[model samples]
Target: MSKVRITQVKSVIDRPERQKLTIKALGLGKINRSVEQENTDAIAGMIRKVSHLVTVEEI
Candidate 1:
């Protein structure tokens, strides 16, 4: 299965509470922290929700 690398590139401050929680749920709470996760719809949805705050690459 393919994987996606999600890196938090921006601070969560000032963002909506839901987005902040999503970032935490993705196991990323600090800037520049990257987490590898399966490339699935659920994850993709989360990534989309915070697309402005994270960088995602397929691996």
Candidate 2:
């Protein structure tokens, strides 16, 4: 299976509550932190929710 590298490029300050929660759910709480996860629809959906705060690369 393919994987995705999700990096937190921006801080969550001043963002909506849901966005903060989503960021945490993505296993990110700090800027520049990256987490590898399976490239599934559920993860893609979560990434989409915080697209403004993160960058994703397929691996």
Candidate 3:
């Protein structure tokens, strides 16, 4: 399967708790932090939840 690079492009401070948790769950907290994950349904859903705070790239 292909992979995706998830990067936290924005700060989580003052954001919703759920959003903060989601960022951490994706292995990111600080700005520009990134994690490589499999391109799967679950990961896609998670990305959708925080689309405003991150950037994604297929790898």
Candidate 4:
């Protein structure tokens, strides 16, 4: 599978619970933190769910 890097660029404060959990599941909590994940449909869905809170780049 291809790899993608996910970076938490925004705070989770006041965000929805589901979005917060998605960020955690992505291995990110604090701002500027990053996690590398496989570029799969499931992961892609999670990224899309919280797109406003993060930045994604192909790696």
Q: Considering every candidate listed, which one attains the maximal lDDT?
A: 1
Q: Give a tens-digit lDDT track for model 2, residues 1-59.
A: 79999999999999999999999998999999999999889999999999999999999
**What is the model-wide C-alpha lDDT for candidate 2?**
0.96
Off by over 4 Å in 3: none
lDDT tens digits by residue: candidate 4, 32-59: 9999999999999999999999999999
In candidate 3, residue 33 scores what lDDT?
A: 89
**lDDT for residue 55 in candidate 2, whole number 0-100:** 98
Better of 3 and 4 by lDDT: 4
lDDT per residue, candidate 3, 1-59, as tens digits?
Answer: 89999999999888999999999989999998899999889889999999999999998
Q: Model 2, which residues run further than 4 Å from truth?
A: none
Q: Please report how far candidate 4 places residue 58 from its true position, in Å.
A: 0.4
Per residue, candidate 1 scores C-alpha lDDT tens digits across 1-59 of: 69999999999999999999999999999999999999989999999999999999999
RMSD (CA, Å), candidate 2 to true, equals: 0.6
Prediction 1 TM-score vs. true: 0.96
Clash pairs, model 4 backbone:
none
What lDDT is reached at residue 42 by model 1?
A: 94
Model 1: residues with Cα > 4 Å off, grouped in runs:
none
